[model samples]
Target: MGTVRDILQTKGHAVYSIHPDITVFEALRVLVDKNVGALIVLDNEKVCGIFSERDYARRVIVKGRASKETLIREIMTENPISVTENDSIEDCMVKMTEKHIRHLPVMDHQDRLVGMISIGDVVKYIINEQKYIINNLEGYIKGTR
Candidate 1:
């Protein structure tokens, strides 16, 4: 039941982004260097698109486009779905499942990009929450208060 703001607070609001004009190869390098599965495409500090390993596989490799030659703008998912800090983690899970996406960019009230969350992040948080609930239930059953 935690919000995106809680996740950002725990994980830190570090957003990795790239320009659309960059080559897919360059973007891949950034992905590898940052150890993230996706990058937000920003133009003039505005969210424009998103590039992911899935994008590279489906858009570049499947289409026989060379990463070194293909620009990110040519393959990135334009107008990607985003979530606000106030949105609940469960809401994000539903959105991601419905959209068939693994990553989401977190935005502030002003529509400024604040962070990014992956499916792994959400799953981990939910699992931890469940563990806490179970522990509390067991403690209550034992009259441990």
Candidate 2:
């Protein structure tokens, strides 16, 4: 219904990132500290990959790799699908659905990381929009503005 810019404006652009060279164990600590589901993996201030709980469950735990010894670069999702600030929320929903991803990194016109959006964020925005429309329709029907 709205653009990524709208979402960012509502929820502030605070992106937590980690270096790819960090160990999975260290990354997990950051994840816990940040209370986030995923972290943007940056290499020399450039977005390189993403590390999430899914990566830990499927890549490290399932593969019998030690979290303390394995680096994020080894298992993080590389070249992840991204969305721009101008992209519509519906477009983001379609991309996330098609990719089966829960999170998307947002970039600006200069390709600079601006923020990250989660499936939860999109769902909440849609729900609020629907509620607003329903309220307006009810108000109009009742001649209440």
Candidate 3:
């Protein structure tokens, strides 16, 4: 079973974040530059919320709010669902599914932000693990293991 730690190790622990006070337009620019769907929202170096493309679509575009004037904090999902490095990939998937969220912030033992994982990350890890298992099993059956 793969853990969040495994994913972080493979993906690198680089978390892009934005200040809560930034305008939605600024956040959107960062999202484009990063090529990611979501960002961890930080305030005073602490995780405060998550800002995503979904938030922009539903809150700003749909509501006719000006992206240049609207604050990210007003639309961001505050106190987002998070997981720790020790958590298994399956656990993270369940949480994301139940919460209807695509991204999850990864925290450390002291509640410090370490990295972030998306649903795509979890699915890719699982698929890789399955491929490894299948290869090993095939080798065993063929007397190659």
Candidate 3, residues 44-90: lDDT per residue as tens digits?
99999999999999999999999999999999999999999999998
Q: Cα lDDT for residue 1, model 3?
A: 91
Question: What is the lDDT of every predicted structure here?
Answer: 0.96, 0.95, 0.96
TM-score of every prediction relative to native: 0.97, 0.98, 0.98
Off by over 4 Å in 1: none
| Best-performing candidate as measured by lDDT | 3
TM value for model 2: 0.98
**Candidate 1 global CA lDDT score:** 0.96
Among residues 3 or more apart in sequence or in different chains, the pairs in candidate 2 whose N, CA or C atoms overlap within 3 Å are none
**Regions of candidate 2 where Cα sits further than 4 Å from its true position:** none
Judged by lDDT against the true structure, how good is candidate 2?
A: 0.95
Instruction: Sort the candidates on lDDT, descending order.
Output: 3, 1, 2
Better of 1 and 3 by lDDT: 3
Clashing residue pairs in all predictions, respectively, total 0, 0, 0
Prediction 3 global C-alpha lDDT: 0.96
TM-score of 3: 0.98
